[model samples]
Every structure is written in C-alpha cells, then in structure tokens.
Target: MGLLNRYAETLSELGSFVLPAPLKDMRVGLFNTTLANELALPEHLLQPQTMLDWLHSPVTPLTQQAFAQKYGGHQFGQWNPELGDGRGLLLAEVIDSNAQPHDLHLKGAGPTPYSRHADGRAVLRSTLREYIGAEALHYLGIPSSRSLCLFTSEDTVYRERPETGAMMIRTAPSHIRFGHFEYYFYASQKDKLQRLLDFTIEHHFAECKAATNPYAALLGAVVTRTARLVALWQTHGFVHGVMNTDNMSIHGITFDYGPFAFLDNYEPGAVFNHSDHQGRYAFNQQPGIALWNLNALAHAFSGHCSVDEIKAALSTFEPTFISQYQHLMLSRMGIETNEKEQSLAVMQSWLQILETNNLDYTYCFRQLALADINKAQCPFHDIFVSQENRFKQVTLVDQEKTDAWWESYRKLRLAREEETELLSLNPAVIPRTHLLQQAIELAEKGDFSLSESLLEATSTPYDARWDTHPFSKPPSSSTHTSLSCSS
Candidate 1:
C-alpha cells in the first residue's frame, strides 16, 4: 500500500510500531477511547479502555521513516543553535474528518538524537493536565493543539518527585516553532534553512505560495495570526505563563499549557507561572512578549527577507492586536461597532474599574448583561466583596472627573443599537483558578468526577446555568500563590 493508504488504516486502529531500542525503558500509558471519538477516528483505533491497558501493552509502534523537521527560534531572547523534536517523534500525519491534516506525536515515547541529558518520560500529572486542558481550550474556540490520546504507567519518573510515567498523543496543525529556523541560522546552515522554509511553505503556507517573497509573506502571516490569538487570550483573561520561543507555534495555535491559568480577577499584571519571578510573561505583557517572539522569528528569516520589510511587518502587531482586542471587548459590552470616541471611552473606563478594583473579570461583565446595573441588586456583585466601600470610593472621586467619564460611557451606551445584544459576547463563567485547583486536587486523589464537571462547565462558559456552579469563584488567600509548571 502507498504510505498515505497505510496511514489511513493506522488512523482506524492503534496499529503497532517498532519501539526504537532507546525508548524501551520508558513507560507507556493509553488514552481513553473518548479521544478517538473526538478525532472521529474509527472505534477499533482506541485500544485499551483505560489508560493502564495502553500503557502496559507489549505492542510496539509502527516503524516508519522519521519525519524530522528543521526550524529555528529564540530562547529567552538569545538565539539557539540546535532544537528539534528532541524527545518526541511525529508518528504520522493524517487528515481528520474535517479534512484538516493533523500531526500525531508521541511525547516522551523515547529519546532521539536530540535528547540532551534527561530521560524521555513524561509525568502522569502533567500528562493529565495537557489531556484535559487541550480539550478545554479547543471547546473554548481558541486555536490550540488537540489531545488525541493520553497514557499512564506504574513506572516512576523523578522530576520534583517520583511520579508515575505517562505519554500523550498530541495533535496540531504544525509543530513548527520559530526556534526551528533559529537553529539552522545560528549553525550558519543557510542551505538547510532554505530547505526548511520551502517545506514549510509547501505544507502550511500554500496560500502564500504565489507571493514574490514567500518567506517574508510566511513571516507576515504568522505575525497576523499570532496577534489575533494573543488578543483572544487577553479577552478571555488567560495567562499562558510560559512564552518561550519553542512554545510559540507558527500557525498561531496556543500550545504548551504549562503553568497556565485563567485569571481570578482582572489584574492586568497577573503572573501565574511561579518560575516567571520577573513577570516577563505577565497577563498584560503577553502581547509585548508575542511581538518580541515574532521579532526573533523574523530575525531568523532575515537571510531571505530584508530587515526593513521585517520591521514593517512586525509593526502590524500593535495595531492589529489593539483593533482586535477593542472589537472583542466591545462585543462583550454588547455595544454595536461605532466609530465614535464615546463608545471606546466606555470600554476603557469599565476595564479601568475592573483592574483598579480587582473585580472578578468574568462575572462583572456577565452581570452587566442582566437588567440591573446597580451593584446592590446585582447577583454578580456577590462575587465581589460588599461594594459599599467601592461605591463610596467611586463617589469620593471628584464629581467632575467621574461625571465626564460616566457621561462619555452613557453616550456610548445610548449609541448601542440594543442592550440585549452584548449578552452573547460575554461569558458567564470561566475556568476560574480556584475551581481548576479543586479539580486538580480531586484528580490527584484518583477522583475525576470534579474534573469532568469542571470540564462540562468550562465547555459552555457563556451559558447562564454555569452561575450555579461553585467553580467560578476567585481563589481565597489560601490558594497557591503561584502555579507550578507541571502537567
């Protein structure tokens, strides 16, 4: 059979592969069958009903020609000479039911020539988080990697602790990172860099094939998509925690859900990753970081594209992000698009209040969708402490200053074509930090019920029914001060 035909059959079943000897000591775990169903893969492909069955199966993976891709990227602002699918391998590329080609990767399956010094085993905890978090992000309509399968084993691996071993089948449009190009350039491998660029354009940037300078066009496209993606993250109050070059995808999908969090309250400067002590990837700094990463990527392509052209393309990040964010925020406010300054002023003032007061970001906007805007009668107000103090503070502000802002906001509302329109733009519930922690805590005890419930709630975050769920609350003082970069 042709390679594509053989791949088609494997997609229908968990066809075996010969495990490279280097990976023999690594433990295995299988994902739930539900993952196969999500991918619309054939039923037989989902072997081993539980993760345990798949993990211990003596069956080996198919031995196919390795699809080792080459690319470059920036690491913490410095150029790296070498980085590829160091530990993981791309098993195959299959077209899903949606006709989208997805790369199936076996993370921690074994070490390759790229494995530096660490074992290629993944921890169960991190695997579980990626499994569910990827699914959650997909359902939330964010461009992200999809979790096709997850497996766990009794074997112990030590990171911070001796944890059970696990592996995950990660799916994405393309695993190509900005660092891929950086790797070649830093090695002075211009010919190899050109080959990588050709392959990328052929596989992912076909739309730009006709452009005079396809490499520059490819950079531009990545910049545009990434800007919009980060804007979506900002609007939803999500912090990716780690914005490393290798973690940034060329197609703009959010990947590497390590130390990630949904903000409990609207703190623009919120930092979720404990490792990010300097706050380089804080909530508000995400956009800036994104631009920085893109610039690094552009620098890699400097050989093929002029520095002036790259700078002009990079310039699009700010305006594109601001415009996209403003539009999304306006939709959440249920205000029709109006070119007037008043409409924009209302959004500014409301966000300022949210940030200044440390209000529950998701609830405040959700409550605004209701009939009552008054704090005392607002069910949403309960999410905040008694608003008396806040209200008094608002009153104490120079009446003139407050009145000017309020009048501008009111005028913006007056221009709103209708009040009911904004409801769809704002979501009533987000995967709040406290609730996710609770779910993780329960999952750690071998109870997945809360995790399942939280998943269901987050899947329909905009639904009013979510208001009854306790998972929507902000973390108390006792919650972990920072999230760890674990599964």
Candidate 2:
C-alpha cells in the first residue's frame, strides 16, 4: 500500500461523495497472485483477507478517499446526461518502478450514486469474462486495461437469475473517458471543465502542454490513437458490442469489454449483444462508431474551439483509420505496402473467400502465416473442409470460384515474398467466447483449472504450441457466443 503514496497521483478535486456499500459475507474465491507479483506488491498483501479488508472496510486509508467520478455519455448513439461509475470506484493510483502511475479501480465493490436503480454488482460469470477478456486483449498487442486481481463472495446477486457476486481490480494508465469532459462541458460548468482539462493535460497528456493549441492538439492526438485502435479491432475481428461514449477511453485503449465477441464465423455484420437489436456496434461498424464517439468528444471542446476547427480535426479520423487498417492487413500477410490499393484488393479478396465459404476467421488468417506460394494448395483447401466438419457446418463452396481465388492468392504472394513477420502478426489462438464460457462455467462450479489454463494459453497466443491447444479450434454451432450488456 506504500506504493499508493509514492506516485505523483492527482486525485479528483470534484467534491462528490459516493460511498461504497459493503458485501455481507465477502470472501475471495480466486486471486491473481502472478499479476500481483508483477506489480511488486508485498507478498503478505496477497492474502484474501487483506484484499477483502481493504475493499469492504470503508475506513481503510485507501478506501476513505475512493469516490465515483461523474461523467455523461452517448449510449447507442443517443446522448445520456446522467451517467457515471455505477458499480465501481477509484481506490487509488499506484506508481510502478518506472514511475508510471496506473489506476487501481475496484469494480463490483458496490452501489454508487451512479447505480441508477440497478444492483451494482457483478456475478462470478461476468467477472471471469472481464478477467480473461482484458488479459486476452493485452496479449493480442492491443491497448487494454489489465486485470490485477479477482475475488468471489458468498453473496448472491440477481440479474436474470441469482448468481454469486464477485469483484475484480483493473489496472490501467488512466480511467478518464470522453464522458469525463462531457460532464462539465454539457453542464456549462466552464470552470470545472477548465480544471479537468488542466488536470488531464498536466498528468496524462503532458506532451500536449507544449503545443501551440494544447486542447486542439490533445483532441487530434486522441483522434489518431482511437482511429488506430479501432483499426486493430477490425483486423482481429473484435466487436465491442457497445460503443457508448462513456465506455470510450480518451487514452484510446479498448476500455470496457462488455457483450464483446470475436468472429465466430466470417459474419461482418455480426452483433453478439442481443440487446443490440439494431446492430449499431457490429463487427463492420466499429470504425464508424468510433468516429461518432470522437465527434461527441470534440463537442465537449466546443467552447474552446470553433466548429470548423473541430470538424477539421475530426477529418483526420477516416484517413488515419484507413492507413492503419491497410498497413495491418498488409503486415499480417507479410506483404509490404508498396501499392496500397493492390494490397487492399488482395486482402479484400482473401476476406471474400473466407466469408463466402463461412470459414473460421481466426484460423484462416493464422494459417496464412505458414502459407507457401509453391505448394499445390491441396492441404490449404483441406483445412477448410476439415474446419467445416469440426464446427458442424455443411460444406459449401463453389469449387471453380475457390480455384480461381487460390490462383489469385498464389499470384499475390509470389509477387511480394516475405515470411517471419506474418507468423508473428497472426495469432494462433484467441480467447474464443466458447473457451471463456467453459472457463467461467467451470470456475463458477469451484473449478479453476480451465480458467488458469486459458490464462496461460492466451498469454502467448501466437506460440506454435497453441495450434494444438484445443482452444485454437473455432466455435461450433452449439457454442454459446451471443452475449448481452449483463455479460
């Protein structure tokens, strides 16, 4: 706990008090001791009792200062002015050996002012999802909040049904969201807005302070980073399921992973969140939705800059996203971006082939790492047929069309020859929803073998051994991949 005071932590100056409601019978079912060690936390602090005491006791030095930061957001493309941290609180910011401060957030601790008539608890099922979900994204070369610890309790909380309660501590560079600025901006609280802006630039966006237009430069920086982050999501087939501005981190990381899913098949328009009946956050719509969120962020800075100036900054989103996406696609194929249009054409054709055949998205790109332009391509074609049987999908591909596609692919590869980089870029395993479900299911039943194994497997997703890890396989028809906001 000494680490908390070591950092140059700037706790919120806002005077809103949102007290934590303690659990009745708090107990830890699982603890991530490995991550704790990585953080250089004292070995004695690894015990469940220490964590439960720190979280459940309101008078602890750390907990006493914890408060729910207020913010507003656009939910599913509609502005909601009354939103904040409903089920969590910022306990403190702990600095590492590198002198970098990271937020130590207590999620699912209890109800706050922002609970808005909800239970303000997370079940063991959903906690597991966040635990592995964050870890998976981290290992995938994506910017994400990493989970530090998780604890389960005796209390049962009701969602669709009564489920055991759990808490998870997530560590991130910062927890600031676009809504944080929007909270003051929309309320016409100009002084508070300036305070928050100054605090943000002084602590997190220090580099922006030297710019001629720090606010505009800060907004532009967020635009570029956010565009690139969403591009990475598209490359890997991730659907965020919810793109509410409140969930969009100003730091450009994949902030909140709720109702999220990887491509089960090659369905670009797939909406994993059943609550998303409108498919607003579908696989293909992520880029556009991210731009929409950035637009909301720019509006938060409206009084500071002209509408035309903001729009000009926003204009960079599309080009930044397009270039990043193209570069990622080319790098994954071991092709250089010598001719952007041609490289994209080949990538598009590859996707078309996979989508047309309903092939496994992760594996299709993965095996391409080992692709050979010289081989007759029989083994490659056989993989798809084998995958069809494994996933219980009927074989369906036009042979003539497939043959033509193969020839085109061969020509593309023969022209631009490269190898090792492709293997590193393509992941052999992902935290498949099916695997997460099984892990959570077994964990809820007092078995953590699967969850622990999955943690290890996903930690090194691009390793060769994962090719046979069983988790590397695609989701079958019976796999429960669909999720909701509750998930």
The numbered model that scores best in TM-score is 2
* lDDT digits (tens) for residues 64-173 of candidate 1: 43333444455556665555555465655666677666666666665555555667566666666676777667766778888766555546777777676667778887
lDDT (CA) per prediction: 0.66, 0.79
The best candidate in terms of lDDT: 2
> Candidate 1, residue 283: CA error in Å?
1.0
Global CA lDDT of candidate 2, please?
0.79
In model 2, which residue pairs have backbone atoms overlapping below 3 Å?
none
Error of 1 at 35 (Å): 6.1
lDDT of 2 by residue, 238-260 (tens): 88889899999988898877888
TM-score of 2: 0.94
